[model samples]
Target: MTYSASANRYDTMAYRRSGQSGLKLPAISLGLWHNFGGIDTFERGREMIRRAFDLGITHFDLANNYGPPAGSAETTFGGILKADFLPYRDEMIISTKAGYYMWPGPYGEWGSKKSLVSSLDQSLKRMGLDYVDIYYHHRPDPNTPLEETMAALDLIVRQGKALYVGLSNYSPEQTREASRILKRLGTPCLIHQPQYSMLARGPEAGLLDVLDEEGIGSIVFSPLAKGILTDRYLNGIAPDSRAAGPSAFLNPDELTEETLDKVRALNAMAGERGQKLSQMALAWVLRGGRVTSALIGASRVSQIDDAVEALRGLEFTSEELARIEAILA
Candidate 1:
């Protein structure tokens, strides 16, 4: 069956400029970090991708180490792209990253030119694409020189393997230096990917400021805090939940009584705002104009619908903001 995208797909969704770059990302993008791998059903993953595209989610994020067996998510995504998304390639922004133990040996990971370049080539082949819209260094390598990593990114752009370069999980100081080096190399940093949500406020302290200062945009990941802010855990965790599964990212122990109490309180506030807990959580992340997009992970098509509805309640009054801060504090 041929997949024809919704005619009004671009009508309702909001697109925001990524910092000072010409690229504009959808306010809500999808991440394939989990549940789109070899371990999961291919049909379900394909349906999620189709549903997301129908809802105007133009960006899909990936990384080298995303799957359980590593790199399987890209393979799965590649298959989907080949089948349904190939026709819409120009209308979408695809991104993938490298860093963090991809292979067994020392050279398999980290920020070396070899690691970053080779990993991206492999990612391109796995995804069956000529070039990715954005390529990211998954994390900062403490031991690798910033010049080498930034140069590798510059080289990628020059090689036409990637159109723009970004950084992920980098601190304020690290971002500043990398942005400086990239600027010197004539490849200005386009955006930054970081973990930011109600539960994770580390970015609020100084990371956002740095991005603003450097003229770099931010697309936040884990905006729901691994489903902690959603109603899925309002009751006890389901046996099939990610927490109950074999995911190292989300564990059953993370759902502490204290966390649940906070989530319940937040859920109540969301009700007052006429939104679901997940919707409110996503809106909260994008409340301020600082964040360019909220990168979400979905196991099902309905999760994408819920996230799109979040755009409706993005604005909040001062009182609501204060109350949310108080609850989080």
Candidate 2:
């Protein structure tokens, strides 16, 4: 069947400016980090993408080393783009990152100009796109000179391979330095992708402040703490859960009794607010306007629906915020 986007897609999801840049991303963007891989069912992954667009999720985030086999997610997404999203390219924001361990040997990863440029070329080929909306350095490379990495990003922009550049997993100091270098090169750092959630408050300590000071928007990943903040684990881990998988990032041991108790309390609070635990978790991340988007990974179409519902109860009073803090404490 032909996929026609919903007419009211633009009416529901909120769009926030990417820093002071011209780009305005949907408040809830879809991330192809987990489920959209070669090992996963192609049809199911395709369905999630279609459903996300119908719900006004215009931004799709990806990375070079996303899939289990690495780069397979981009291949999957490329086929879908050629099939479904090609016509609406102008309406969507697609981003992919380099850095991290992509391949073996020295040049396969990190912040070298050769690695960054070559990785993006491969990504563009796999995704079947001439250019990506935002290209990111997947992480900061301590050994590589910041000037080289930032210059490589600026060169990609100048060469028309990417519209804007971003940084991910960078510390506050690293971000400030990278932003300074990019700005000097006539390409300001547009956005930062950080691991931020109620459970993971590392960014809150200082990363968010640097972004505000530098005018860089943030789209937080793992807003649900790898599904811990969701109801998926409320009754204990299912066999098919990520925690139960062999290569799972979320280990079963992490689900200690104390953690579960906190989760249950948070779930109760969410129930009082007429929301599911997952919905409230997402809303909590976007409560303050500091975060431009909550980048969510969904295994099924229903998960996407739950995430969209989060927008309805995004507001949190001081009391609710304090209550959440106490629970975290």
Candidate 3:
């Protein structure tokens, strides 16, 4: 199906602003970090992108290193873009990242200008696009000079390869430093993609405020905490859950007795709100204005449908907030 065909349904989901920029990202954006990988058939990956657009999700996040075989996710997604979403390319915000391992060699990864610039060109070629809506440095590299990375990002925007620049997995201090450098280069970092969830409050440690002050938007990844904050693990690990996946990001060790107890309490709180744990988790992230969007992943259409439904009642009482904090406490 094409975007014009899906345009009617696309207006159903709310679109939030990206930092101080003119771009407004869908409340629920799809990420190609996992299921839409080389491990799956291209048809399966394309189907997810089509379904997402039909469900009003217009922002697609990807990286050069997403597929199990590195570049295959972009290649697969590029096919879908050409066949289906190409007509609505201007209507969509497609993002890709660098700064992670993509190829073999000493210069293949990290924050160097050589890596970021070359990786983005390869990413665009793989995605069959001339320019991405936003280009990101996947993560901060301690070894590479910060100025080099910022300069590379600025170069992309100036060269019209990427309209905006962003950083991911950056600490508050690193974000501030990058912001200053990007400003000096006159490209200004547009957003920060951090992992935030009811279970992971690391962003609250200071990153949110840093982004806010610098006028950088935040679109949080794993807002469901890799499905841990979802109902999938409330009782026990499901046979098909991430706990069963290959990612070290969510290990069995993380499911400590204390963590499970917290999950149980959170589930009870969800019941009081008349929402599932996953729905509640998504809503919790939207409660604050600082979060521009929640980057989510799904194995099935039902998960996307449920996340959309949660947005219908995205509000919590002060008492409920206190109770949630008490549970997490």
Candidate 4:
């Protein structure tokens, strides 16, 4: 069956500008970090993508090292793009990153000019994209010269490979330095993606402030703390859940009784506000408008639905915010 996007897609969804750039990403964007790999069901990922676009989610985030086997997520996304989204291509914001451990040996990863350039070339090939809307250095390289890394990004933009550049997992200082270098190269940084959720407040210490200073928008990943912020583990880790998987980042040990207590309190508050824990968490991250988007990962189409439904009640009273802080405290 041919996939026709919903006519009402843009009517109900929210879009926020990516920093000082003209690009406005959906307040809720989809991240292909998990569950869209070659090992996963292709039909499942396709349905999720279709539903997301129908719900006005225009930004799709990916990277070369996203899949379990690495690079397969882009391949899966490319297959879907070619099949269902080619006509709507101009309406989407597709971003991919390099800098993680991809292949082996020196040129396979990190921030070297050779590494960054070669990685983006391979990423473009995998995703079947002539150019991504935003390209990022997945992480800062300790040894590589900052100039060389930023220069590689500028070169890619000049070559028409990526429209804008970004950074992920970079510290406040690193971001400032990288932004300065990129600006000097004539391509300013557009966005920064950091791991921030109610459970992970490390960004609050300083990263968000730096992004504001740099005029860089942020789309935070793991805003749900790898599903902990969701109701998926309120009782216990289900067999099908990520926590139970061997490669899972959220192991059962991390589910301390202390943490579950906080989860239960938060869940109760969310109930009082007529939203699910996941929905409230999404709203919490988007609160104050400092963050541009909440990058969510969904294994099912309904998860995506719940995320968009969160926008319906994004506001939080000062009392509610204070109570939340007390609970986390």
Off by over 4 Å in 1: none
lDDT of each: 0.94, 0.94, 0.87, 0.93
What's each prediction's clash count?
0, 0, 0, 0
The digit string of per-residue lDDT tens for model 3 on 41-126 reads 67777777788888888899999998767888898889889888777788788999998888889878999999998999999999
User: How far off is residue 74 in model 2, in Å?
Assistant: 0.2
In terms of TM-score, which candidate is stronger, 1 or 3?
1
The sequence of per-residue lDDT tens digits that candidate 4 reaches over residues 118-220 is 9999999998989999999999999999899999999999999999999999999999999999888899999999999999998898889999998999999
lDDT, candidate 2, 1-329, per-residue tens? 88889999998899999898988999999999888877788999999999999999999999999886699999999999989988899999999999999999999999999999999999999999999999999988989999999999999999999999999999999999999999999999999999999899999889999999999999999999999999999889988876776446687787899999999999999999999999999999898799999999988999999999899999999999999999999
TM-scores for every candidate against the unseen true structure: 0.99, 0.98, 0.95, 0.98
lDDT for each residue of candidate 1 in 1-329, tens digit (9 for 90 to 100)? 88889999998899999999999999999999999888889999999999888999999999988886699999999999999988899999999999989987878998999999999999999999999999999999999999999999999999999999999999999999999999999999999999999999999889999999999999999999999999999887888887777666687788899999999999999999999999999998898789999999998889999999999989999999999989878
Candidate 2 accuracy as lDDT: 0.94
TM-score of 4: 0.98
Question: Model 1 shows how many backbone clashes?
Answer: 0
TM match of model 3 to true structure: 0.95
